[model samples]
Target chain A: DQQVKQNSPSLSVQEGRISILNCDYTNSMFDYFLWYKKYPAEGPTFLISISSIKDKNEDGRFTVFLNKSAKHLSLHIVPSQPGDSAVYFCAASALPNYGQNFVFGPGTRLSVLP
Target chain B: DVKVTQSSRYLVKRTGEKVFLECVQDMDHENMFWYRQDPGLGLRLIYFSYDVKMKEKGDIPEGYSVSREKKERFSLILESASTNQTSMYLCASIPGQGASGANVLTFGAGSRLTVL
Candidate 1:
């Protein structure tokens, strides 16, 4: 069973619009959440993260909101640009494990068209 | 800046052949992980090491093994390469403790293996 799930396989948005990628987890033990972005033939780069203690965290145009009660998290990118097109992965892990077992979602491919 | 380097970017091998994928991290982080990413299946952990000479099996350890001979290197080995084992392998490292409470992982570019 997949502990972390990205329901959408792909998403598309127009330039200068907003792009929202959603992720949900079945395990309540996950207390730390993160988002990573990857381009073709490249490694994933950490984009943003939010601890369970807070509901939201923002980094420049990228914003991550956590809904602990629902066990869901969403990443929002405002003014989405064409360069934002890539696969986004959602990961979660328990802090005490010290990043030993990070559960990653299947990933959502985002395309920002101009 | 922390960087994880996977020596082989791509490789091709015949069935029953032994394969080795090497990874090294310059950050000297205590935790190192080997994961394989497949289409639709996502990143499945194969093994992880928390300390030199110590290793732990992750979700998918079947037909795979790992080695951590030193603090900076982690190696993933395929005893007998099979067609089903063909996938992209990614290596990552993270510190044991952090001020932010959440440790971030630095990833290598990844190694794609093809078992014929």
Candidate 2:
């Protein structure tokens, strides 16, 4: 079962524009959500995260918004740059203990046009 | 910076050949994981070790096995590699500190393997 899903496989946006990526989860037990960015031939790097307790978390150019009711979350990048072009993955974990089962979405490849 | 290193960045092997992929973490993490990344499939966990000499099968463990004799090193072995096993394999680590109940994963560059 695909607990986490990224409906869009690819997206493109103009440089300096806002970029939005969406993710949905079927497991309501998951309370911690994270986003990772990956470049070609490289490992995934952590970008931002949000807890189910809050609706939104912001860090400079990146912001993550969580809607528990909808079982959905989104990552928003303002002033998107060419460097932001990469595959973004959304992951979720229950976090009930130290070592919890984590699940990842299929991932969305974003292309920022210069 | 926490470093999770995968010994091989790329490898090619023939079908029915035994293959081994090594991973090491410098940060003394108690939890380590192995995953395979494929197009449209994302990352699927193959195995994970929570402690030295301890291992657990992840979502997809068929045709693969792993060993964690030491805390810092985790190895994935393919008894007999098959063409379908060709894909990008990733290793990740998580500190046991369990500081704030966070399950953040530190990943390595990944190993791309091809089975002919």
Candidate 3:
């Protein structure tokens, strides 16, 4: 069973526009959510994260919003650049067993067109 | 800057052969993990260790095993390699404690394994 799901397999957006990626989780125990950006031939790097306590978290051009009631989260990148083109993964972890297990979504390929 | 290094970037093996993928982290992190990445499946955890001599099976542990003999190194072993095992393997590390534990997961470039 896939606890975390990224319904969209791919997404395309124009440069200088906002690019939004969505994710949903079936487990209510998950309290921490994170987003990672991965490029070809490279490892996925941390982008932004949101705790269940808060509804949103922002870092520079990236913003992550969490809706606990709906078990949904979204990552928004403002003024998307060509460099933002990559596969984005959404991951969730429950507290107390934080480092022990992390469930990852299938991932969404984001293409920022210049 | 935390650095996670995988011993090999690519490897090829034949069916029934034993394969080992090694990973090392320089940041002295107590938590280490192994994940397999496929085209659309994203990253699925195979195994993880929280300390030296300690290990735990992750979501997908079938046909895979891991070892953490030292504090800085973790190894994933495939007892009998099969064609279906061919995929990109990734290793990650994070501090054992604190909120960053679940937030930051530094990953190695990845090792592409091909089981013929």
Candidate 4:
């Protein structure tokens, strides 16, 4: 069973527009949510994250919102640029973890067109 | 400069052949992980090491084994490769220092393996 899921397989947005990527999880125990972006041949890099205590976290143009009651989280990228186009993965883990509770979604491929 | 490094970028081997994928980290972090990426399945952990000579099995550990004899290296061993085992393998590490960075992974440029 998939503990975390990205319902959208892909998304397309115009440059300078806002891009939103969503994710859901079955495990309510997950307290932390993270977003990672991956390029074609490169490894994934951390983008942003949100703690359950806070409903939202923003880093520059990127913002992550978590709805603990809904067991859902979303990533928002404002003024989506070509550089922001990549496979974005939503990951979660129950804290006090050494790696066991961690789970990642299938990922959403975002394409930004100029 | 890459903090985490996977030795091979691509590899192909016959069925039943022994395969080994190596990972190294220069960050000197205490924890390292091995994960496989498959279409629609996302990243599934195969194994993880917290300290030298100490390892733990993750969600998917079958058909895989690992070695972490030293702090900077972790090796994943496939005793007998199978076609179903073909996928992209990634190595990652966390700071393990505090809650803020513990769950964040710094991954290596993955190794794509094909078993035929």
In DockQ terms, which candidate is top? 1
DockQ score of each predicted structure, in the order shown: 0.75, 0.65, 0.66, 0.71
Interface RMSD, per-candidate values to 1 decimal: 1.3, 1.8, 1.6, 1.4
**lDDT by residue for model 2 over B1-116, one digit each (tens)?**
89999999999999999999999999888889999999898899999998999999999999999999999999999999999999999999887754532478889999999999
Residues B5-111, model 1: lDDT tens digits: 99999999999999999999997788899999998888889999999999999989999999999999999999999999999999999887763433888899999
Clashing pairs in 1: none
DockQ of 2: 0.65
Q: What is the lDDT, from 0 to 100, of the residue B33 in candidate 2? A: 93
Distance (Å) between predicted and true CA of B8, model 2?
0.4
| Estimated TM-score for each candidate | 0.97, 0.97, 0.96, 0.96
User: Model 3 over residues A3-67: C-alpha lDDT tens digits?
Assistant: 99999999999999999999999999999998999998888998988889999999999999999
Q: What is the lDDT of residue A82 in candidate 2?
A: 100
Docking class of 2: medium
Q: Which is the better candidate, 2 or 3, if ranked by lDDT?
A: 2
Q: What share of the true interface contacts does candidate 1 keep?
A: 0.73
**Model 3, residue pairs in steric clash:** none
True contacts kept of each: 0.73, 0.58, 0.65, 0.64
Q: Candidate 1 or 3, higher lDDT?
A: 1
Q: State the lDDT of candidate 3 residue by residue for B46-109, as single tens digits.
A: 9999889988889889999998999999999999999999999999998867745445788999
Write down the worst ten-residue block by lDDT for model 3 chain B.
B96-105
